[model samples]
Target: MSDWAYSDVVPWWPYVFILLGGWLPTDVWRYIGVVSASRIDETGEAATIARTIATSLVAAVIAQLVFYPSGALADIPTWVRVVALCIGFAAYQLSRRKILAGIFAAEIVIGIWALAPGLG
Candidate 1:
């Protein structure tokens, strides 16, 4: 075996291609968003769809964390995570749906939970 991880290496050009390949897909969409946003109405169906998609993505991430946690979070009990989520959601709603408040509440709960006697 050589000092490299792979037997074959294509050098600089291939690395540049790989970088562009990873960036172009998302970059193209961002440019499209910039162009379309100038004509898109804030209250239109497209805006609603975008908001719904964003909300769904966030919900999916939360679900993933609760159902299949990783790293240090995996050590905490699932019920505790769910309870923290609930408290965060409630605090969010109570604070007129403020995102930061909800995040802070959830983080505080999780931090305390991590400090619990039997937890890590």
Candidate 2:
């Protein structure tokens, strides 16, 4: 156990345990949400609140990426990130609020910016 702990690489067992530890709580909540939502009308207050909370969480994550990124994202210029986000939001609005389209647009724009001569 000491040797495993000292090594740079984590053993397979720890990864398995880590995966389960990370996934179980989220999966349990997801299961509960699915079961609970089955009985809730889509037009009900509860459903609206759930949707609002989910949207707020996504927005918070996007805001965090823009304001407090780590690793490679931290290295990107703020203007580039803001531009990418604006393009993404525009794409989302133009694409009838398709989230994937928006995300892809942002990623593509940033990727092109990074690949541009003298950038990144």
Candidate 3:
């Protein structure tokens, strides 16, 4: 981790730079999303695609963190994650599509599930 390490040097065939190159692609998409979002509406095709991407990304992250999870999430049962998602979905519906309610309800489900006799 020392600053004087030779690996920090900007060599021509630099692997260090390549390793850090991933940030550009991610940032490009973020900037594109921001710019394009301004031109789209709640029901436009762009919005639809954006929503689809957002939903897919969220689902993928949750699924990965549930099924192939590490850290604290690895301790919970699969049923708990599924139940939490369902509760969030139900909240999404009940709240008249309010996203915040869905998020809060999912957290509530996690808390309740954690407090349950088996999950703790």
Candidate 2 off by > 4 Å: 1-24
Worst 10 residues of 2 by lDDT: 1-10
Clashing pairs in 1: none
Candidate that would win on TM-score: 1
TM-score of each: 0.76, 0.72, 0.57
lDDT measured at residue 109 in model 2 versus the true structure, 0 to 100 = 89
Clash count of each predicted structure? 0, 0, 0
The per-residue C-alpha lDDT of model 2 at residue 6 equals: 27
Question: Lowest lDDT 10-mer window, candidate 1?
Answer: 5-14
Writing each residue's lDDT as its tens digit, candidate 2 over 30-98 gives: 999888877989999988998999999998998999988989899899989999999999999999999
Q: Which residue runs of candidate 3 sit more than 4 Å off their true CA positions? A: 1-51
Error of 1 at 51 (Å): 1.9
| lDDT for each candidate structure | 0.87, 0.89, 0.82
Q: How would the candidate models be sorted by TM-score, starting from the highest?
A: 1, 2, 3
- For all predictions, the C-alpha RMSD in Å is 3.3, 4.2, 5.6
lDDT of 1 by residue, 22-110 (tens): 87888999999998888999999989999999999999999999889999788878988988899999999999999899989988998
TM-score-best of 1 and 3: 1
TM-score winner, 2 or 3: 2
For candidate 1, give the lDDT of residue 23: 79
